[model samples]
Target: MSAARDSKSLSGIAINNSPHVQQLQKTAPPHLGLVCITFSKEVRFRTITRTRYLQLPEEQRETALKVLYRENLQRLDLALTFCVRNSIRLYRMPSGLFPMSDLEDEIGATVLEKMSADLAKIGQRAERLGIRMVLHPDQYVVLSSDSPHVVTTSLKILDRHARTLDLLGLPRSSWSLMNIHGGKSQRADQLVGVISELPENIKSRLTLENDEHAYSASEILQVCQRAEIPLVFDAHHHICHENLDSYDHPSVAEMLYAARETWANPDWQLVHISNGEEAFGDRKHSDLITAMPNVYREVPWIEVEAKHKEEAIARIASAGFF
Candidate 1:
């Protein structure tokens, strides 16, 4: 990689209340974050299926959890180090770090507590380093499912996510959020109701995002307002769902500003940036962002949720887009 530009010339975009953000405001680039999966070959998770791990005998299963959790934590440490060296301060931690952690009974409290303590150290290091950590559970984590069983299962997944963040010692605030789209548009009202019922731990750190098909930014904004949670404005998703004739349509700018206001703290505002594929304007993220709505350029933090990950960010940096 080429030498990073002087931090003084970088945007003083702050995210989270950590002093690190304050520190970076004076010496770091704009608050651009990358989603999980590093492009560099520093460290990687050799993940396993929950089923395969659970199929083992009780004693063996417990051992597997310890081993897997330890490896993920170690890899996470190395990944954070890589981010620091590369001038990447914001990162979305993978939800798969502890596969099927919702199975607390099977894993046993002793093992779970140990894992949590270990991971908390990583979170502390991230805080100390001024990196903002975040998470986005998979699409299957839908809290608004009409089926009672699906809703119950969705809460379990959310509970697991909350427990993980808590263990990492991340602030239960917009700074360290778990963002998800409004599940199943027909149940939008039900979704808002269910969000109200969620444990404060889960609800407080949660952020609602507008998806490509089910909900437009306008619609999701209402849900976020009702639930008193922040909104993540995805430029690509907005374009796909908004039916705009061009990416620079006025509605894009309107939604961007509207979503930014939903954030409880101005510094905590985050937006998702990506490009759509050609067919049907499919939501598949392109390798590089050639252009973006002008409004997106003003957000404090933008997570590049593209297929190319760091390479896409590198392209943006190389193009002098940030």
Candidate 2:
């Protein structure tokens, strides 16, 4: 594949020494990465509690959460180390890193503060390693929900995520974006209105993504334009929901280019790439990316959201798709 138009500068690959870095240095974009949850038999790492906090005795809930939080942060440190060693520059953190922060409001702040130093250290390490770290809260976090309670809880979750990024000393910009999908299609307008009122913490670093269901790329682009937040274009999601077959398809390319405009920083214009399972299961990310739409070769950063994590990334490289 030919080198992307501006791949070298965008992927931060000029100075790296690892052999894996060579793969990135090739013609396509240099920074190709995977999301959270490493699948390694030797490591056996997990950033979540083995037992649910609420299931514990009431008196023990606080203590359990503390232990879980500490372990999770420690695992995050390990994960960061792994990324640096492997020359993986972009990563999406697992939302469970701070457990119960949304449901148990009173204790969440205290627990997060207690781990601030450690979290900051991890963030600093990531910066040093040239890793572009990000987070995606689960489906439950819907800022556009019709229910006030859902919106309220969603903000808390988003606030916690923003605060976590703040603790890492990440700037209030696209570099440390906390991305979310445009919620139910019917509420796109409502979602934008609610987003306008969010505090600077949640608003400044927020991003909206196009999901396979509900909102199409065009729909989310409107929301992103209105909210002035970056839009994360997902190739598979668009193909499945937007009726676009491949990234290089003329119509799909137009929408992808439009989505690129949503990003304020061209250096951090992150996109997602994945192949679906079957026609009926198009929403499901396959274990390996069988093919990537040719149009993605020049994008700044593409988060490989396959079930196989790093393994899928290796497969993509082997296939010479980029």
lDDT of each: 0.76, 0.74
Q: Model 1 Cα displacement at 86 (Å)? A: 0.9
For model 1, how does the per-residue alpha-carbon lDDT over 170-201 read when each residue is reduced to its tens digit? 98887889988889887878999999998978
Best by lDDT: 1
TM-score for all models, in order of appearance:
0.88, 0.86
Per-residue CA lDDT of candidate 2, range 1-54, in tens? 212221222222232333322111225564777587766642233443535655
For candidate 1, the 10 contiguous residues with the lowest summed lDDT are: 1-10
Q: After superposition, how far is residue 61 of candidate 2 from its true place, in Å?
A: 2.6
